[model samples]
Target: MIKRYTELADAVEHLLLEKNSEFICYLQPVTSREAALQWLAQYRQQYSDANHVCWAYIIGNTRQPQTQAFSDDGEPSGTAGKPMLHVLTERELGNCLAVVVRYFGGVKLGAGGLVRAYSNAVSQAAGNAELRMISPSVQLSISVSFAFEARLRQLLQQYQAALDDVAYRDNVSMQVSVPQDAEPALREQLINETAGAAVIRQVASHSGV
Candidate 1:
């Protein structure tokens, strides 16, 4: 479970020159693979004349990502994208996408040079950008008897949980969002307070409040 992690606060772009070759690095926060690809497409189209567009993305926690990928584009097999991604992981950036567009400057940099160039490009961009922490939350559906409604409400407030929805039926059903770190304690309290009658089912997990 991700209690908290750092992420880019906003989009940033940086330019570097190596042996006259231009490397334009773009950094943006992205929550999903689709969004990463969409942002990459925009950069590709924007820099259509560039020689190569290399990209990498980490869609969840950097320490333990849900998914991540990289593309070298037309660059050497292990030159561009992997090095850029290494820089991002080193900096512990989560939910971020990096795209580097290279414009051939009439000079050929060897594989080693390409790797350093790409890595340095992303590193410099990240150094210049702002980062903020995110405490992810889980969405849950809880069912409890009417007898425990008041107690549950108090617990929710105690844990600073968000009340999303409430439905009164055979039992009182509630939709809630709670901080990942607080969920275990909340669950224990719910069960103990309701004398093991309360039930909780996780619906989804997401970053932010």
Candidate 2:
């Protein structure tokens, strides 16, 4: 089962220092694997002078994580990326990416120190970010009469649904996206409101918002 997940509202930054070495961590919001890679590439290019750009990301639905990847960026075998990945996975974050850019100072942090620094950097950013819950929903298309349009829209509010698309023809055609759990009740309400005139069909399922 998946708990509620949140998106990072804005980019977050955290800094960790060990023996004069500066680790600048960036937490960026990413909804897809492609987006994650794109953002990482942008960061790498922007910080081309930095020592290392270690990164990790979790992309998928609330119920299940789809794709995950982490890179050490030459930090060490098990130091930078894996610890950052652990923080994201343990929190069950959705569509999130964690990148820690290291600017090596004169000192060298050991493997354990690197692990703690990387994990703490991501964790601190997560704490400071604005997270939005990932809501699971189903897409549905409904057909109803023009006269019942207003009522159908009202019923959507009560049924926890959102209106996606609508068309005015001989009758009214609409595409609505409703919560997966509330579909049954929403469908029942539609039938009663339209007096059997409303037709509802499941179109697709969305993993998260």
Best by the TM-score measure: 1
Note each model's CA RMSD in angstroms: 2.5, 3.2
lDDT of 2 at 84: 91
Q: Residues 2-107, candidate 2, lDDT per residue (tens digit)? A: 4446656678888888778888888888878999999999999999999999999888643367788899999889898889988887765667899999888887
Task: Encode model 1's per-residue lDDT on 1-209: one tens digit a residue.
Answer: 67688888899999999999999999999989999999999999999999999999997778888899999999999999999889889998788999999999999999999999999999999999888888888889999999888888999999989999999999999999998899999999888877788899999988882
- Model 1 poorest 10 in a row by lDDT: 1-10
Global CA lDDT of candidate 2, please? 0.83
lDDT of each: 0.92, 0.83
Error of 1 at 49 (Å): 2.1
Candidate 2 residue pairs in backbone clash:
6-132, 7-132
Q: What TM-score would each prediction reach against the true structure?
A: 0.84, 0.80
- The positional error of residue 168 in candidate 2, measured at the CA in angstroms, is 6.5
